[model samples]
Target: MEFMDHLHSHSGLLRLVPRRPFPVTIAPMQWYRLEFHMANELGTLLPSTFNLSDIHVECSLLDKSPAALSSHWHIDWQLLLQQGAWDSEPSLQIQFLIRPINTSLPPHLPAHLMVMVSPTYDGDNSFYMLPLITAPFCLTSKRQTANNLVPNNRAWSNYVTQHMYRGFSLPCFDQRYFLIRESWVHGTPGKLWDSALVISDALARQLLPLNLTRPLKVLDLSAGTGVIGLLLAFIGQHQNNTMLDITLTDVPEALSLIHDNRCLNKITYPRLSVAPLRWGIDKDIQAIQAKGPFDVIIASDVLYEPIKFQDLVKTLDKLTTPSTQTWIGYKRRGLKLEEEQSFFTLCHPRFQILDRSLDENVIHCFGWLGPHAPTLTTSLPPCLPHRVTGVQIFHLSKNSPQS
Candidate 1:
């Protein structure tokens, strides 16, 4: 497939001009430039009519208590206009003056900047928000600068390769960088799938309240590069109150990448570990069982395959204690809604699944503007002006046996 075709296939409406060096990194107190050019799936300019005055830049870290990171920095809109950053058409360009990482702002590590274009300035005009136009950059202290390495087989090498995700950062609770290896199946760490973000968002909002008085043992089952588990462990370490022992498990093929990612984060928590686990295999389950029951279980975007759904639930049943809570975040794969429905139907008998899709409380923590406006919900801000159609998070606990 051609380069542009590949990108259009993966990301329908979002296109990055000069899409290279993804997971854009920045040193503390340095200056960085951001470009905002948006187009729909057909490669046509979207929202073509907009004055510079109609553009607004909003910045925030994806955090439990997110605060604006763009307030005190300098922006040069005129320089951007002169250069014509967007194909000599109209594009928004803003130079960001990086600042010291503010601990007060709930530690949204990989900070994101949103370029919103309000179509009309007339009284009470409705506007469209483009979530694709984002600056997914991270700020590192001088000493930790070496952590950001450019991969040789770069995922976002060109417009074509960009469709195949190489690495991505989870912004909140410190930036967790993940390197992606191609998977034969759907779930991989490289793509910031909605399910992963949902799990991260849930943890950030309720980390303290959920584990306030007791230390909790956590598991990220079928973890792809350990994104969900690693985020929990790092966030717990940052909090210093809720003690968390995290175990990241997946098939043997995924173990090496998981180990590499754990190292990439420089985890010093002393309790995080990774091992191989295949669902429905006795030996694999035994390895997990050796660690005993976990307090909480997290799985993201792992239920798409219909054949493995039973084994997955069985594994969860074995690993979780009576009081343990399992959180599953799922995004619909293609048009197959029945597959999701079937997974839930089988799960209903053993688990009391609470539908927490698009929880307002979680949204509020991550800077949710009124529903229709372009709001930052987790890492990928919903730019569509509508809720993400099929993405949701469910809270699962053991259901009592019926007499």
Candidate 2:
């Protein structure tokens, strides 16, 4: 917990780090000071584990191109103990330094940094650290393919993907919801968030009570990797209770990914199905509606583009039934509070906001059917803001006579 406290104090470091000039060199002995603190109390007891808190580096710019600047840098850091006893040797516990051929290349700005400690039989746990970042730099020359711009370096791409996947493993739920995934197919973090597995977890947990007699019919809109639907299927299969019928729909490009994921998960349930469902497409909407009133509808991080938002809302209005509960979770990106408020206002007349929570820049909204559902505003309150995000629950009853 002490480490967690220290990290909380330095949460600003989690933001994207600006790209500096490249090709500048640094001495072996001199490196920017880096500090790390274990944020998980349990991590401290784990053998050969360390948590990253802050990273600092110094670099100089070498060449400026239309797309990016190139620079070299040096990094130094102190290792904080999260788990197991440190070796008696001073070197084992002392601050260490590493000087990788740091290149701050243009167009590739750092977004977020990740550090992981992997234990080995002979040597101590090795630290695999990577910074997740991107910059918008256009190429001056025309390119035929994405690979033409970047070299064929799978290592860097894999490293970035692994970093993102780890973020997905972090705890982002309460008792009401928990993410479930049988396995990651593409295993890319950036794509995972787009999958909205977290939202599906929350919806499944909320609807569990309603599925006492028969299997729950769940619909996942904009399904990317099909993580949400797969997780629900896994839960249903394991519990051996009610059957979980899942229908996943997305654009063609995303549908292919969903199909591969479904196959990768070895899903054989008669109720599990995947199909293409694009917003604003009449055929897609009708096909989705044919599935009938699903008990739960889950969508996550799908409200970025303005056009897509309107299309999505319109599609929801047509597909949702009085008995269906729709849940939407979005990470705050370019969308402003006013825009979000406007969105809610437009939907408020049709769907009720039953529950809401904002944590780690992510907003979760639970909506139910009916016109007279209760409108509740729950805040985090300053005291518990650090621990739990704002949690609000809303309810709409289709059976209500007033509706």
Candidate 3:
């Protein structure tokens, strides 16, 4: 099948566009443009009907504490959000110049601009649309920046709650939880993926049909961004499901992202579990098995590497028992159908494919209203949104019952 060639899912997700060849220096009282754009996720760039008036734009210090921010200098810029200016079509991006206003040069130095939806605005409460600050930059002053302090990862706060999820027919947890992600520049594990969104929403919807009277155990394999297991954990809490035994696994390199995301969501032990897992590692599989037999196992976009097909299948065969319901969400970007079938071909008698479906329109409404409104726009690599397919879901279970 024809698939879209996109760098990453930025659609519906707001981003502070990185300036090409990042500026070497930022001077105070000089106008530097900060362009905030929502990257495209699905094949389509969703429009933003978000009221312009509700959004706020300003500059912020890179390493200053939230408490310290209130006492220090303040910088204000054009908010760009106007009544008829942008609300007519509702753009996905806004840019304004930010310059220090106060008399202080800031011994710590002001380094980034913040684009946030005002706390007072009662607009769509989706986490994907939460505010974003630009990546840290250099200040003109000779003084050290960030006071030589920079956190490993930048945190974006999205205070959406479980109540917001009740209404969507096909909703994935938006900024509903205070979830955070590392940029691809940092590592791919932390960035959100469209497949994760589509699959999690699909699985969550399927769980609702069970009425969830009993305990539920879940596994999110290759749980980048921790979106899948995290969402289920929230759902489990809402359902009052016992134990809240949700575990997320990925490579060691990827574990920190999952850990950070899980923490930012305020989910803790007994409620959420994160472990380092490599698909073919026997030790990892056995360690994870001790926590099993899961009621449902879920994964997204793990089939991208054709060479690793056997390893992933092997891991699935060992982790799942006859009753374990497995869901795998795959995006066929630039992959041949045969390449995908090859993965299922490896499962053989060890597992059975129960059902398969596609989320053709998982979120067609969530378009990116950026430089190319009604079209794809991102600071990431190029792709065509029209050719993107809804993620493909694979439901599986052990072929025979186990003792």
Candidate 4:
């Protein structure tokens, strides 16, 4: 039984890491491919016993086309069973398991085990036996390959529909910080933002406080997924135990999505509202100001184009009050590092940079400016940890004249 289990485990790992021929062609383009290797040994043996067996696996690109193409590859497993047969001929079983890492169930099969035998098997070779097995398993795929395996979108879609997206529900967060909404296009799945995570961390770190006695008004500019505002509302509920007024502002195309997300999340207060505001446009700024005197403003992943920096600054200048705290989170992208520095350089005099932190690919922060703050150098705090790639946090705050 132990040997059989070992064989099954070995085959399962091998199934996950199949090699491909180099320089596989996709249409006219050729791509390099790679494979992920699995570790040895099934469950640990009791003492010093050692078990060894030769395992061989092969994979080939099958089809890649609109209907079906030959660029995508399917993995085929062939293992030589050498162990002495007790009562039955050796067989191979493949298991398809779906497990999510973030405490959320993955969208497919919990566990599917299929037993197969060589065509030469004398008994029951005509039918395949599939048994459902429910257990936790790691989910990963090949990291790299020598052959460019054009993904089979059709098959992949079928696999996801049949296996991945059906059984799982949207993950729930304690603070109600995420805003998950479907795309405006029909049949598209919904999206979520982790605003609550950001805001809670910032507040705990003394970057900002929840001032409930005074009405907390939040402005989510370029609100891609309305994550920032959603987080603010979640935090406000905890600190003030009251509803937060949040304005979701974005371009015309995103407004409908924002509204849909707001409704889907069922955010009940400080009165969730949506407004169309294009960055750098006066009409848009005026329209956003109609809500007026925002206490906190948030933006996430909004700095991509360099041309939009000045307009963003202009919009910020119009929407923020002298004492307001504005938080902007952005993922670093092409030219983003230099462009962000340039943005801070221009806005440092008018706003005080309060705090900043980098996690994964995102930059999180809080900033404030006095009614008439002086020009300040863009120097981040020394305590911020340096990232593995040597990227340091860039934080600038309005300095008091004496300092």
TM-score of each: 0.58, 0.48, 0.58, 0.45
Better of 2 and 4 by TM-score: 2
Q: State candidate 4's TM-score.
A: 0.45
lDDT for position 267 in model 4: 52
- List candidate 2 segments past 4 Å from native: 1-190, 194-197, 200-211, 358-403
lDDT of 2 by residue, 267-366 (tens): 5556777888888788989988898678878765566676566777778888777788776765443456788666666566677765445342222322
Q: Please provide, for model 1 over 2-64, each residue's C-alpha lDDT reduced to its tens digit, 9 standing for 90 to 100.
A: 544333332322322323223455554555555555443224453433334554444332211
lDDT of 4 by residue, 77-124 (tens): 334343323433222322221122333433332222211111111122
Summing lDDT over every window of 10 consecutive residues in candidate 4, give the lowest-scoring window.
162-171
Full-model lDDT for every candidate: 0.53, 0.42, 0.53, 0.40
Off by over 4 Å in 4: 1-211, 234-240, 336-338, 358-403
Estimate the overall C-alpha local distance difference test score of candidate 3. Answer: 0.53
* Alpha carbon lDDT at 24, candidate 4: 19
Off by over 4 Å in 1: 1-18, 21-187, 209-211, 362-364, 367-386, 400-403
